[model samples]
Every structure is written in structure tokens, then in C-alpha cells.
Target: MSFTTRPEITGTFGVATSTHWIASAVGMRILEQGGNAFDAAAAMGFVLHVVEPHLNGPLGDMPLLMRKAGDAAPTVICGQGPAPAGATIAHYKAEGLTLVPGSGLLASVVPGAFGAWMLLLRDHGSLPLRAILEPAIHYARHGHPVLPRVAHTIAGLAEFFETEWPTSFATWLPGGKAPAPGSLFANPDLADTWERVLAEAEVAPDRAGQMEAARLAFYEGFIADAIDTYLRDACVMDAAGGRRKGVMTGQDLADWQATYEDPLSVDYHGWTVWKCGAWTQGPTLLQSLRTLSGIDLGAMDLNGAEFVHTVTEAMKLSFADREAYYGDPLHADLPVSTLLSAEYAEARRKLIGATASRAQRPGHIAGLERWAEAAVARAGRDLAAGPGVGAGEPTMAHLTERRGDTVHIDVIDRWGNSVSATPSGGWLQSSPVVPGLGMPLNSRAQMFWLEEGFPTSLAPGRRPRTTLSPSMAEGPDGRQLAFGTPGGDQQDQWQLILFLRLVHGRMNLQQGIDAPLFHTAHFQSSFYPRATKPGHLMAEPAFGEDVLRDLRDRGHEVEVAEPWTVGRLTAAQRDADGLLRAAATPRLMQAYAAGR
Candidate 1:
């Protein structure tokens, strides 16, 4: 057997994995306390907001995939907030903006993560509201060791925050300086906020009512009041290099709530893989799988040039479709059925050849050619811009100045309940702190186009096609799997690669996660400036020079990443025999899996 960075955690009781050890521990603690996977996942989600503040926050968005013990398939919990009523292409253009500023009040969306978690707890969780939030409040008030990357991200934006976003400066830099790496850092304001929410929730006198009370406290109560007051007159510097006020209001918060939706699924080689819906970039993975189903992936070496090239090419095609057609289904006529159809996949698969193609190619469906054309036109436009002062999602260190990304949580309890959630957007750099709330607004609005007639066009009350995707699957042997990663555009890409290895290459959970990872940035990014790198493929150095050379020979613009730096993935699964398994990437030495 090949060596893995760590053993795949195995247990008969429960397992949890996350981007941070503290969050994973919190989840395990919940499980140990007799809470189910939903309860544990809710606790982990809140704790992650505290510990990985630079990566995610209360105001961020999340796409969760959850399966109850007896359920045949996982369901989706969409924590993604929509564009505010005042958010529109006309208003943005009037502000002299072509694209929504990647950072700043102008890019604010209705905060959804908090509401989503509350919804998850209310519907599926058995724990009390206070039990789920206590850990996060503790970390925020008492303090947790600040991650080095968090410090570096704060330092990079220190000057900008101090000068342009003094509110952010005051919050992130308490003593007028970025906290030193590993230093105990606390956000008393955030702690106080949660404490107040809890106090209000407790008035309901029961778990279910308390959960609803907490939701109201955040959406229609103090949380919304604070955000509304902050954005009212605060014209702050944004990623577009301009000062702008926001359009979000308390009413927007009052109008929005996290909802549940059916997951989109596709069967591949006896496994039924599930993803959050077309509203996110989740369908891209399904599309990739459909395309790959026609190919014999098992015939190629998992880490060799042939495997890398084939997967990369398939991803480019899938992501190309993402740019063209994937958007909030509530607002657009998405051709999801056709996009995931077997015939369409076969047709698209024919386009993949021995050489890399640099073109942006979204498949043409009858009558949907306009969307595809719009995608090509938007991608072709030369919008020469760089990531504004804290404007992009946390991705690879080399990919953005703000090296923070998103966070993923995977949990499975003894009862067979499971959750895979990817939460992101309200990074420390996304926007200024909302004064009293101790968290910034999400910049998800930047994912919407300012142009009209496209599914992703900026519109009030529409969910931005988010890159925050979580995944679940059921194997032929009846093992239920919950898996996901943190990279924005690369979330599904990295997940697709790992799933393939686990299914075809016969690697254990840890082996698949620890294996050298790779992804292509050959499609328009979902973040600010929306840059596209044609034929670009980034792989970890562990893939070896020979494989890299082979990729280059196939016309891939291969860039070798630092050893163990490609993906931040975590996974958990419940086998048919009642055993639980979990694993996390050792790429950044941050992610951890906890199980007996």
C-alpha cells in the first residue's frame, strides 16, 4: 500500500473532519455528548466561523448536503443569500462600475450562513440552540490561537483597513496591530453578539422555538439592525479602486431565509453522487462526471500525465458550461436537464483530444445558444484588472494576495446521519467589519454579472451562482460518503479528483486525500475580476517532473505548486457495516480528522 500522510480515522461511533483541528474537535465533542451528525455539524460550522475567521465568517454563504439515517439520498440546505432588493445592474453602472467591487459594501449580499445553520438545527438537529453556539462563543470570547495565514492575511490588508476601512482596522487589529501568528486572539464583539442571540433564543423555552427565535434575532432583529446602520452611509474603498456605499438593508435580511432544496445527482459506475444545485457551481462536477463516464479512467495511472490531462481537460469543459449556463434556477431558465444528460456528455466528450484546447467552449443547446454566446463574449472581453485590496476568495497562496479560502466540514454519526458543508465569502478581507457585529458582509454579489439577459446577471433577490459546493454520494456497497474541500473554483475540481481516486484507484480515504492533487484554472473564476487562465493546470510537486513534462507536452500550461499545497480537502463516510471513516488533507498542516 502507498504511504499516506495519516491513517484514515476509523470508528464505530462517529467521525468528523474539518479545515481546523478545533472545529473538528468540537464536532467530535458534540457526537460524544450524544448529538447526531446534524447537531455536530452545526456546532462545527459555528466554531469554524470563530477559528477560521480569515477563511469564513457568520455572514458568509454555505451549501450543505445532508443525509438522515434512513434517507435514500442526501438533501441540500442552501445557506446562500441573494442579492439585496436595491442591488441592480443600473445602480452599479451608475456608480461607474462594470463589475461589482470584489470587496466593499457594494458587493454585500443578504448574510445567509447564520440563518442556514439555524435552519439546519431547527429541522434536523436534536441539540439545543445554546449547545450548538456555546463553543463558538467561547472561542470568540476567550480566544483561540490565531492561524499564521490569518495573521499574514491581516497584515497584508492592515494598511488598507487602517486607512480606508477603519471599522475593519478596529476589529481585526484590536491594539492597532495585526495579531502575531499563533497568538491568542479573541473577538469579544462577536462573542457578545452570539451571547445576546442566545439570551433572546432562551426566552422561547424550548429547542425548536429557541432556534426560530435565534433566526429572528439575527435576520429581523439586532444583527440586521447593525448591518443596516453600518451600510447606510458608509462609502468605503472597494476592490474596484473606488469608494462606494452599499444597497443592502434590514428589509433584505428580513425578507431572506435559508431554504432546503433537492440535490442534483448523477449515477456514475454504480455510485450516485449528489451535489447542491445549479444555483452553485455544483453541477459542474456532475457534468465532469458525465463526461468522464464515457472514458475509461481506470486504464490510466491515477497520478500520471494521462490521468491529469484527461481530468484537467474534462474540468475545463465542465467549467466552461458553468460560465455559460449555471445560475440560480429561481431566476433563470437553466438547461440543467440537458447539461447533465448522457447524450450531451457523450457529445461533449468527443471534443476532448490528445492536446489541450485553450478556447472557452460551452456546449450549444438549441435555443440556449444565446447563453453560451454571452458566456464566450463575457470571457473574451479584456477586463484588465487585478484583485482589489481584499477582494478574492481564499485559494492557493500563489493565486491571490489574500491567501485565505473557504472551509469544509464533514461529519458522520453512529446513526448514519452525515453532513458535507462548504462555507465561505465573509472573509476578513471581503468587507469592513459591520461595526458591532464583528463580521464582514459577504462579497457574493461579485459573482453576478452586471450585464443583462444572462442567468448570472445582477438582480435583486437572486442568489449568485456561488462556488461554495459540498458533495455526498452512496457507493455500490451502500456506504454513505460526505466529502468536500475549501478552494472556491477548485472546490468541485479537487473533489472530483479525490472521488475518482477513491472509486477507481481503490485508495482508502486518507490515501485519496493525501495523494498529490491538481486542478485547472482554465475557466472564468467566480471571484472578483473574473480572470480566466486558458489551458492552465496547477499540480502539486509530488506529481513528479516526468508527469509535469508529459502534461506540458500535451499543451497544458503546467505550473508545479509547492509540495502539498494544491487542495484543502476533508471527508467522512459511514460504511454499511456501521463503521465510520474520516480523513483530511495535510497540505497546509491545518486540517484534521477526529474519530476513534
Candidate 2:
């Protein structure tokens, strides 16, 4: 029998799993109350915003992957907001900045998570908006147990919040100090904010009208006004080491809207994997799968040196392509079809050699590689030379220090509605608190480049090439899986490891997630102060000493980490036999999965 942290949760009704136990319970409760996966997901999303404020907030961005009942394909609900009209490369350079700051006003985009969640709730969910908003409101008002890590994060930034961002200090530090862990910490302001939106929504005639009212309140009414009012006059310190006022106006929020689009997919063996378009790092996972499909991974020992080497090498090649090509498709010509094509995967597979390569080698894209080369040159000037390059923003620093990443949720309902969503960006440290809202803006602007001509170059109204990727795949046996994890560049890398185990090794959901994890940092980071480590690979010590030595012999710079220190993955699925299963990672002790 395969070892697993917890037995796979099987039920006939529905299942919900998330990085946090409370959020998962909230979702499961919704499902038990006859809500669909979309309804449960919406409630769970709001609950996450409340209970895991250090990891996510209402103003964050989310990209959802959902396959509704009877739909043949999955769709992407893109909540990733775009750059403001005044967010010009010239303006940033004029501000004495080389790269976008990882935090503060200048790093903000029009808030998109609220809109996206509402969109999901309005279209696919069965419950009224009140049901979705209540759980979060209760937690925010009545209080929830504060995670020790969240308290520590607040303590670490206490001085900065107090001296630099008084609004943050006032909101996070209730008594001029961080709240104790296990204490019931309440944010009455956030509760009031939600209540006000709900009140405005209730004035409308019906459910659809009520949702429309809430949308107007968020995007065009008071919420937008509050954000606009503060950003216009507040000049604050950012990750770039300078105090600057953001260029985003209320008009930017008014003009922006969340949208839905077809998910990009590729077939690997008999499995069909789905991901968001190039605008996200989602497609990178597909590209890696395509490359690995050409190799007979099933023949290799699952935990052997050969398996690790092959997967790592394949990931490196695909990430190199991400650096060279992936961007917002609306702004540039992203040859996504060509990139994920079998022909491209075949040619790229040849570059994987017995010995690990040290250079960042992007495959030749006829018209784009020259610009890609220039981008490499621009990025080559040691991003580490700058103060903020390589160092993530304040919230990102909290993530590394506390091992806190983004939040993910996977829900599968009896009716066959399945959703996988990764919601991130807004955290207490990502920006100053928005006064009465008791939340911060997202710093997603850091993903953009100041350099023009590159696919990911900064531009007005273009979505940032976000690293927040969620995944869904269908097996040959008609088993549908919705799974994802929360690691910046490591998201797809870890997910790939789990996937290979499931397909080639025939492991179940819990077995695959419970298996030891490894990832490479050989590509450029998506965060500010972007940096890359050539041929760098980190794996859990559970891989054994002999395997580690063999990897070293293969020319990989391997770093053995403590067991259970990497990859906080969660998953939910429904098999052809009508069995619903869910699993959550035990690594962080925070994640949980629940079902009937």
C-alpha cells in the first residue's frame, strides 16, 4: 500500500480542500447546504480573504479554472487586473526607478479579485450574494484565530508600519503591537466594508440586480473612491527605496472589468491538461508536460536520479521559453499554439543533455528571439546590483520568512461542477491599508518590465504576466482532477511532480501529494529584484543519500532541504465511478480537506 499523510477523503456528495482548514470547512459547509462548487468556492474565497489576510485579501487578483456540468471544456475567469494608463515605462524611469517596486501605491493595479469572485458567484453559483458574503463577514467581525506566522509577520514589519505607513500600523497593530497567536483578532472595518456593499446590493430588485449593485459599489462607487482618494495624495516608500505616489486613478478602476476566456490545453499521453492563457504562468506547466511527453517517464524509477534529472531539465527549457516569450496575449503576439505544438516540444527536447546546462537557453522563436536576447541582456546586468532587485516586496519577504505563500482551493460538487482557483496579491505588507476598508492593494505591477519591445514590457492597460496559475486535467478513465499549489515559481514545478506520479506511477491523489517534492530555481523570478540561479535544484532529503549523490554526479547543484518543507499542494476530484475525493498537503499543518 502507498503511504499518505491522510487517507483520500471519499464521498458521494461533494468535496472542498484549501490551504487553510477554516476556509475548507466553510466551503464544505456551503456544499452541504446544497450550494454548487462555484458557490462553495466563492464562500471559501471570501473566507480566505478574512482568515488568511497575511496571504491574501479582497483587493488581490485571482484566475479561476472551472468546468461546469455539461460543459465539454474548462474556462478561465481572469481577475488579474491591468496596468494603469499612467503606468508608463518612461514615467517609472523618471521616478528614478529601474524596476517596478514590489510594494506600495506604484505597484497597484485596479483591484480585480472582488470583481472576479462576484462574477463567479453571479453566473454559476446557486446561492444569493448574502450567503457568499456572510461567512467572511462573521469571521472579520467576530474574530478568527490569528496564525503565529501572521503575528510574527506583523511584528517584523512593526517598525516599518509605524514609521512609514501609519495607516497600516493602525490597522494591523491594534494596540501598538502585534496580536498574540490564537487570539481572536477582529477587523471590524473590513466587516463594515462588506456589510455596506451588501446593503447597497440588497436595494436592487433581484439576485442579478443585487450582484450588479455590488459590482457598482466596488468598481464605480465608494470603494473605488476611497482607493482613489488615498492613492492621489499618499506618497509612501515602496520596495524601490523611494517614496512615490501611484499613478492609478479612480477612472482606471471604473474602466477595468474582469473577463472569462477559453483555457489553453495540451494532451499528454491520454490526459488532457488545462491552464489559463499566456497572460499567466499557467501555460508553462502545459509546455513542460508537452516536452516530457516525448520522453518515456514511466520507464524511469519514480524517485530515482534519472527521473529528477529529466524533469528538472525539461522544466528549465520551458521556463527559459517563458522568459523569452510568455506575455499578455492582447498586448503582443504570443504564439501559444506554436509554442505548445508537438514540433516545438520535439526540437526543445533535444537540448536536454546528460549534463546539466548552466546557461539560460531560449529556443529560437523566429521574430521574437532577437527581442528576447535584448531582454536577456537588459536583465543580465546583475539585478542583484540594485537594492530591491531579487529582494521581494515586504509581503513577499514575509512569505519567504514565514513560509507563507498564496492561497489555493479545489472544490468538486455532486452535479459535476469542479473549480480550481489560485487567489493572491493583496497582503498586509503588499501596500498601505486602504483606511476604512482595512485591506491593502496588490503589488502585481512588479511582474512587468520597464524595458520596451519585450513581450512582458510595461504598458498601459496590459495584464501583468502573473505567476498565479491554477490547473485542471482530465484522465483517460474520465476522472477529472482540480489541483494546484502556492509557490511563486515553484507552483508548476511541484504540480508537475505530483502529476507524473499520478499518471505514470498510478498513485492516488493523497499518494501523489504526499510524495516528496523538489523544484528548480534556474529561471528568472517573477517578483521584483528578479534573479535566477543557474542549474540550482532543491529536493527533500527523503530522496535518500544515494539518490542525492547520483544527482550530484549528474552535474546538478542539489540542495537537500528538511523533509516536508516544500510544496503545499491540495486537490479535489471526481472519478468515472461517481466517487468524490480530496486531499491537502500536510507540510504546513495549515491545509485541510473536507467532505461528507
Candidate 3:
């Protein structure tokens, strides 16, 4: 047997895996208490908001893939909120901005995480609203051990929080200081906010009524009022180095609600992989899978330079398409059908060569040449800049900047029900805390382009093409798999590698997650100061010197990362025989997988 950081948890009952140990435990507890995977995933998501506040929050965005027992295909639960009615390119231009700031008020979107969780729990989940929220409330009201990275992030931003965003300072820095690492830290205000929602929800008689009441309480009632009141006059420093007020309003919240949609899928090697729609970068993974289907990845050494180069090159092509064409399907006419077609993949696959390509090359769809041209032009621009207070996402913390990231959860109950969710945005550093609400609003609007005529252009009521992607698939033998990770742009990249290893190399869950991972920054970033490094690749040093040298020789701008620092992936799967299995990456020693 190959060495793994941890054993693949096996059972017939249930399994829960998450970026944080506490959240995983919370999910497992839900499963133990007779909740299905949807219920368990919802509970874990709320707990993640409390425990990994720096990574995700109650006001963030989540895109989840769920498969109910006996369902042949997974469905998408789009928790991604849209740009507010007032968030238009004209308004942003009037504010003297070229790109949407990565952090602060101007980048705020309608908080969607809470709505999404509620939607999941209300429709598919079997638990009461209170039961799903109790774990998070307990952690938030009492306290939980602060992660070292969270402490470090707070310490780095202490001065900024105190001077520029006092509300945030009051919420994150209690007693006039950042909490020490491993110290118990609590967000009583957050607890209060949820408790109030629960109180309002319980006023309704039954489970269905309670869920509806909770949704109203959050979107049309107190939560919306609080956010609207806060953003009304709160202009603050943003990534563009200016003080700006947001365009979001209570009406935006009231008008928006999480919705369910069909997931996009591509068949590869008899395995049908599912992902969220083009609204997210989810289809990039699907596109990459299609592009690589023509290659013999199973014949290559999984950890060798050839494998890394081919995958990275394929991802570059796919992400290039993401920048050009992927956007809110509700607002734009996306060429999704053509993009996922086999002929398109065959045409794109021919672009990969022995050497790296230093160009952003989106495919030539007849009527979409302008969008492709805009993407290439945008990529060539030198928008690289230093990180501002709320500049980047957490997964990119490895960068010189102290950034925040997203969190992921995978749950599979004994009945074969499963969910894969990636929850992110609304980092503590993203904006000031809404006065009484402990959580900050999301900065997801940073993903939109200030330019006009593009698929991802800034417009009111449009969903920003988010990088938050969760994945699901059915193997040849009818086994179901649910998996995802937390890196912003690297989310799909790492997942692709893990899935390929599982499909081709036949590695077990733990072994696949434990394997060395790499990702390329060849495409434009989805954050503030959207920078692009044409041939850049970051890989874990565990790939060894020979492989690294070979990659460098192939013209990859290889940057060796610290051992096991590349990805924080977690996965769970159920076999045809009814056996359940799960695994999590040991990269940060924070992710965990729990099962019977």
C-alpha cells in the first residue's frame, strides 16, 4: 500500500470531510443524529462560518453540487448572489475606478451563503432550522480555538482595522488585540444575529414554515436591514487605494434568493463529472477534462514532469476560456454548448506543445471573437499591484501578501445522499463588520470587469463569474464521489489533479489527496488587481528535483512551494457495494475527514 498522510476513512454509515476539523465533526454529528448529507453539509457550512471566519462567513457565497439518494445526476445549488441593482459600470466609473476593488464597500455583493444554506436545508434537508444552526451558534457564542493563520492575518491587519475599519477591529480584535493562536475566540455578535434569526424562524409552526420564516428573517427582515443600514454611508479604503461606498441595498437582498439549477457534466472514461454552471469557473474543470480526454494521461507517470506539464497546459487553455466566455448565464448568452463539445476540445487540445505558451488563447467561436480579444488584451495589461488591506483571497496567502481563502465541505450519508460545497468570500479583511453583525459582506464583486461588452462586465443583478466551485461524479461502476478544495483560482486545478489520479492511477482517496499538487497562474486572476503570469506554475517540493528540473526545462516558470503547501483538498465517495470512504489533505493540518 502507498503511504498516505492519513488512512482513508471507511464505513457504510456516513462520512464528512471539511477544511476545518470542527466543521467535519459537526457534520458527522448531524449524520449521527439522523440527518441526511444535505442536512449535514448545511450544518458544516454554518459551523465553517464561525470556526474559519477568515476563510468564509455567514455573508459569503457558496456553489454546491448535491445528489439525492437514487438520483442519477447531481444538481447545482447556486448560492452565488448577484451584483446589486446599483452596481453598474457607470457608477463604478463615476467613482474613478477601473477595476472593482478587491476589498471594501465597493466590492460588496448581496450576501448569499446564509440564503443558500437555508435553501438546501429547507428543500432537501430533513433537519429543523435550529438543529442545523445550533452547532455554529455554540461555537460562535462560546468560543473556538483560533487558527494560527487566522491570528496571523488579524495581527497583520490590526493597524488597518483600528484606523480604517473600526467596526471590524471591534469584532475581530477584542480587548484591543488580536487573539493569540490556539486561543479561544468567540463572535458573540454573530451568535446573537443567528439566534435572532432562529427566534424569528421558530415563530412559525412547523419545519417548512420555520425554514421559510428563517429565509425571510435573513433576506427581507433584520439581516437585510442591518446590511443596508451599514452600507448606506460607510465609505472605506479599498484595493484601488481609495475610499468608496458600496451600491448594495436592502432591496437587493430582498430581491435575491438562492436557486437550484442543473449542473453541467462531461463524460470522461465512462465517468460523468458534474460541476456548477458557467456562472462559476466550474465549467473550466469540465472543459479541461474534455480537452485532456484526447491524451493518454493514464500512460504517464502521475507524479512526473510530463503529467504536470500536460495538465497545467490544459488548465491554461481552459482558464483562458473562463476569462473570455464564462459568466452568469442568466445575463449573458454563453457558448456553453459549443465550449463543451468534443470538437471544440479536439481543436483546443492541438494547442498544447512541448514548450509553454506565453499567450492567453481563448478559442475562436464565430460571434465571440470580441470577448476572446478582450480577454487576451486584459491579460496582457500589467495590472499587478501590491496587496491592499482586503486585496486578495485567503488561499493565495502563500503569496507575499497576507490574504484570506474559502472553505469546502463534502458529506455522504448512508442512504447514498451526497453534497460537495465550496463556501467563500466575506473574509474579515474583505470589509468592515456590519455594526451588530459579526460577519462582513462579500467582496466577490471584485471578479467583475469594469469594462463594457464582456460576459463578466459589472452590471446590476448580474452574478459575478465566481471561482468557488464544488464537484461531483459517478464512476464506471456506479460509485458516487463528492469532492472539492478551498484555493480561489486553484480550486478547480487541484480538484482536476486529484480526480485524474483517482480515475487513471487508481489511487485511493487518501493517496490521491496526499499526492503532490501543482497549479499554474497563466490566466488572469479573479481577485482585485487581476494579474496574469503567462507561464507561472507553483508546485509542492515533494515532486522531487528531477521532476522540477524537467518542468523548468519545458519553460514553466516553476516556483517550488514548501512541502505539502499547494492544496487543501477533501473528498468522500460511496461504492456500488454500499461502502463509504473519505480523505482530507494534510497540507495545513486543519482539514479532517470523519466517518463511522
Q: Give residue 188's error in model 3 in angstroms.
A: 0.5
Better of 1 and 3 by lDDT: 3
Give the runs in model 3 whose Cα sits over 4 Å from its true position: 394-401
For candidate 1, the 10 contiguous residues with the lowest summed lDDT are 394-403
Give the per-residue lDDT digits (tens) of candidate 3, residues 480-567. Answer: 9999999889999999999999999999999999999999988999987888888999998889999999999999999888777888
lDDT of each: 0.90, 0.86, 0.91
Clashes of each: 2, 2, 4
Q: Over the stretch 1-596, how does candidate 1's per-residue lDDT look in tens digits?
A: 87888999999999999999999999999999889999999999999998898788999989888899999998899899999999989999999999887888988899888888888899889989888999999999999999988888888889888999898899899999999999999999999999999999999978989999999999999998998888888998888888889999999999998999999999999999999889999999999999999899999899999988999889999999999998999988889999999999999999999999899999988998988988988887776564457567745637554644799999999989899999887889888999888988888898999999888999999999999999999999998899999898999999999999999998999999999988888888887788888888888888888999999999999888888788899999889999899999998898999997
In candidate 2 the C-alpha lDDT for residue 523 amounts to 75
For model 3 the TM-score comes to 0.99
Model 2: lDDT of residue 251: 92
Best prediction by lDDT: 3
* Candidate 2 residue runs with Cα over 4 Å from true position: 385-399, 402-404
Angstrom error at residue 248, model 2: 0.9
